[model samples]
Target: MFNKHGTWPMKSSLLTRNVIILSMVSFFTDVASEMLYPVMPIYLSSIGFSVLLIGILEGVAEATAGLSKGYFGKLSDNQGKRLPFVQLGYALSAISKPLLVAYVFPLWVFFARTLERLGKGLRTGARDALLSDEATAATKGRVFGFHRAMDTLGAVVGPLLALLYLAFRPEDYKMLFLLAFLPGILAIGFTFLIREKKKERPGFISKTKFFDFFRYLKESPSNYRKLLVPLLIFTVFNSSDVFLLLKLKESGLGDTLVIGMYVFFNLVYALFAYPMGSFADKWGMKRIFVFGLLVFGGVYLGMAFAEQIWVFAVLFLFYGLFSAATEGVAKAWITNISHAKDTATAIGTYTAFQSIGTLMASSLAGLIWYSLGPEYMFIISGIAALLIGLYLYFSKL
Candidate 1:
């Protein structure tokens, strides 16, 4: 029997509780974070930071999270616990949200953004590990996809909430910051309901060498290499979302419309995420991932040439579709390639590469935007996407 909350009857599998709790956690935290995300670039610009500094700050914030994900994921595996790390990450993010309201200085904003990203890094690998542990192999894609749907559901609501807050309180950005804490606190409260599982340690102690993880990955006879190379190539063109917002601003959209476009993207993401995952399960993850990459390339191309408000909005929606198809499914693919015992480590490694990709993409896009124009940034990204497609077509996964 299912509960009113739509949760299925609790069973021995990790799918039910872990997905439920993590989804709730993500939904609430996103409500808090998205409240500020759409407006952040404008806020920074208002406070006298140039586009270059904003790019640096955004890149640094994301890279910081990427850098920590593997380390914290490994730590969680070593310690054999997921809930504690998840809890800690959520709390830190919650605390950081309110800090934005209290401080107006640029450095403070940086610290707060970094803190939030750190929280994300700390929780990501462990969270994926937990989801994998709980799910049966056959249903792993569905489980993760559901979690992504839930997470995107939060993303969808967050912008709407931010829009409402801004509607009534146009002059007070701090209030939105303060209001973000509500969803975060709720997410934290629900986390205590999740049960932790015990991990079995191998008889021989694994060496803690810096490259030890990659060595294991190399030794494994899995299709990981097949997926990793293509995915990494696709990531090279996938710059930060800040560029999208900046593009919208450049096109003369108001802050309200820009945030509304973000809401539209998240709405599409939330709607299609689960179906996309289910589709992948029925077909194959590799095909879906590649298709999404191609779509993403097209979206970027559209953004490069778009001038009308409606055209830009349509591109954002397609961008959402691309994200929904790939993000959670990539994690599911990683789980397919790695052993259960090394789930966190494998996820950490993949996430690290993804972060490195973001760092490179964002930094390069920023330089392009500053030096040439926004159009060049998209053109370069488009070429990278096309190259990734060609590479993946020939590569075995």
Candidate 2:
């Protein structure tokens, strides 16, 4: 006999009720978000936004989300609640989707984009903590990995849908934004099915400063700090995926081909995320993460020289592998070393810093690309990532 809760026939320990529901929610949400992702640059360009402006917009939006992650993560811990934050966050994001096309002004576009990210900031910590609560340290890698796979699976479907729509509708970007809202609404509805165990309040009750999560570093285990430092450094070099898409477009690929490539990359990521997570559990997470960094370095360096369509295909394939290895594995490593009570706070704080680094990274990459060239930007980032990977590989953590 099988469990009645809709778990798979395989190990129930790794795929619990909450994990399944949350993954579904992420699946729907990504479908909504990614539907617009590949075409966003082209759309913005159509509307007169330059690469520099796009970079700044993304940096500011991400910084807003990052700053809030720390605060909201702390608030979730302080309140000993997760479901409310999750519900509200998804709802906000759902509403923000259609707002992208509600108006066409730059300010409105920026507002809509940042609002969606703000919703992401609000939910990330509490949601991941819920996932963390459902698994023990031994299963953390697989648990997080499975969630990522489900999430990226949405990335796969979203772009393909966009690809198909654009095939007939070509440059019909506004309608796509409206269509994306439907999946976001679906994501919000799924969140209603999620339930969370009541978390115990943290031992200390501190003042609610906006940047207070930064204080967590001093109080966290030494290993947490050790692990976070290199990760943050790497983030400073890793810009938004928009850059990659833009590069493909700049290389003279048609809109359909560019979107198709994104779909292909995400498909690879979805396929490999779960298996890589299991591998991370068996081999050390640190080792897997370092390997991912090496792959990432190679891909970026390769991207610099990639002009042919086939070369771009190979680079995207490796890019997907890099994502599969790193994203969930990094969170699992953080959660493993963190105290249970502070799980949301720990992940939130780290992600918050990562977002800040993203701002810097994207902005700098944009400036570099504008001043020098895409090749220089890629080479600098690739070399930096390789050096950081070497440092992490040799580190005691």
Candidate 3:
């Protein structure tokens, strides 16, 4: 059932305990996070914030989270502990949900978004490192894929819940925000229950700087550094999903239908995530990743030119395929090249640069959308992705 590494043990004979628990935690957390996430752009629009402002808000929030991922990643290495950072991060996010309901200003929403992302940044690196710690080289793809599938499954549930609540309450965004608190707390409690095994660590990290995400990269192999080029390029083309969802609403789908589309996207994501990961293991991650980038291009292009609402069901599924292929697979690829001691830092640095790309993309998309509309934004992003995906394939990254 496991690889030869004898690592990242399955708690039972069936699967790893850490994976199962972490998946559960992610499920509950996503359930909470996605419940409010899709609505965020809509909420901002309702509060008289311009599309440009929404783009800026998304960019800033993600950039902040990216910073946290990098910093806390190194901190986790120095402390040789992952659980505490995860716990603290979850606590910060868990408390911030209700505050959104209580305070309803753009500035308050911005603060709430940033505060919640701060928690995510802190938790993400340490948590991923912990996961990598549990994983073995033999099944890293499946392991990470399983985690993503569970996480996306929660995303599916969250949007569905939001859709149902909205169906009845009909724009009761406050109640939806308040109900999110339950799952967030539940996810946090599950974090405490995780039992991490002490593994051998390279003590050399403590002597290095705390915030240096790129420190390990200099020391990493040339192939590792080269692979980063295309990843960053593609990320720069990929802006906020908030804009994409907003695009759907702008296409004349009601707010409720837009949420339904999100739920549908997550469902496809949950379904494909594990299988795609396993496929990557057998077929090869680079091929899958390259294919995913192309799929991203197709999805974006389809959304850009979509003439009917029926097209959404298909394009959104393509979006799910792209997400399943890239996210866990990319992490698995990085983990494969990285030294055991510095997984968190490598992942964090990767995340940080990608977020930088996201910040730029969102900012640019906002400006483009403001002038030309969503169609042009998607067209530009799609063309860029297509070019980048071709480059990555040729580069063999």
Candidate 4:
């Protein structure tokens, strides 16, 4: 679908080049982000921040993503350009890392962390919209899956790099944070490689104003709206990965083993994402997503019952499979069902919902854990997924 300077000897091959470039950008940026991410909670804990402060900080950091994701997404559609926002987002996030490394104080760290969320909000929707622009209907699943795979591979590499650096410089958190700047810059630089296709503005709509975030949702097809209900239900139960890591730590797992478990999870995610995406193309996104929900149900059920370390490991691996089936595959489906003009807006709305869902998931899970027990949190979450999966299947949506 993309014609970049007479390149591409084959149509299908063009998809590879574009997706791979995006993948590289995702890989490098994730490397930059994840390097600091794992370090944050530890750094805060070291500086004698309270768990309450840490919880509040984490909530603000993640929820800020919802604040801007939709706004930037709509702007991309209105302007008919994607690269500028993507580059700027990466730059802001990249710049924030060095700032965090230099100033480890509470106030400075707060701003830096919030800045990172802002960057994610700005870049994600626009970048996803661009990916959709390049892909044909037939290739959407594979393209999105490939992008997520590449993005997650960086997730795999980032923590390992952090772990290796920490192995040498155990107390040098600043150095680890500072080194993140390099990959962040590389990720921003890679944005130059993407070649975006232009679309003509519709005659009825005014060109002066763009990005009507809420109205776009009101006008979106029933499919998009229907899909959101189940997704929102699932997201409300799917809490932060931090909770999973924390569960392991509470169970007396070492820091190194905890990091290792995360790496293993990402590894499984990276391996399965592409294959799942291709399968979604052949079968359907809804069907595969239901299957993923079943996987989630199983993993959470495992978490509820398992008391052993090995059981947690097995559950973590299965959790990766659930992520592989959902993340990119959902975006690809949204791309197909949405209007061409509102594609970016649709993505923004979807992510906004996800951010809200994640916020609810974490807070509610904590409530459940405190009220009943940690095991009850996962048991309730598993049941929610099971009920929703049945709704989706019988509803035949």
The candidate that achieves the highest lDDT relative to the unseen native structure: 2
> How many residue pairs in model 3 have overlapping backbones?
4
Could you give candidate 2's per-residue lDDT for residues 16-109 as a string of tens digits? Answer: 8789889999999999888888788788888889988886787778888999999999888887889998999888888887897788799998
Pairs that clash in candidate 3: 8-134, 10-15, 10-16, 11-17
Query: Against the true structure, candidate 3 has what lDDT?
Result: 0.82
Clash count for each candidate, listed in order shown: 1, 0, 4, 0
Error of 1 at 144 (Å): 1.4
The 10-residue segment of model 2 with minimum total lDDT is: 1-10
Q: Per-residue lDDT of 158-263 in model 4, one digit per residue for the tens?
A: 9989988988899788888889999998988888887676567544444433236767668889989988888888899998887788788888899889889999
Q: Candidate 4 — which pairs collide?
A: none
State how far residue 206 of model 1 sits from its true place (Å). Answer: 6.8
TM-score of each: 0.89, 0.93, 0.89, 0.93
What is candidate 3's lDDT per residue for 100-202, written digit by digit as tens? 6676687987898888889988888888887887667767878889999999999888888887788789878777888999999999999987877786654
Q: Which order, best to worst by lDDT?
A: 2, 4, 3, 1
Q: What would the TM-score be for candidate 4 when compared with the true structure?
A: 0.93
lDDT (C-alpha) at residue 22 in model 2: 93
lDDT at residue 201 of model 3 (Cα atoms):
59
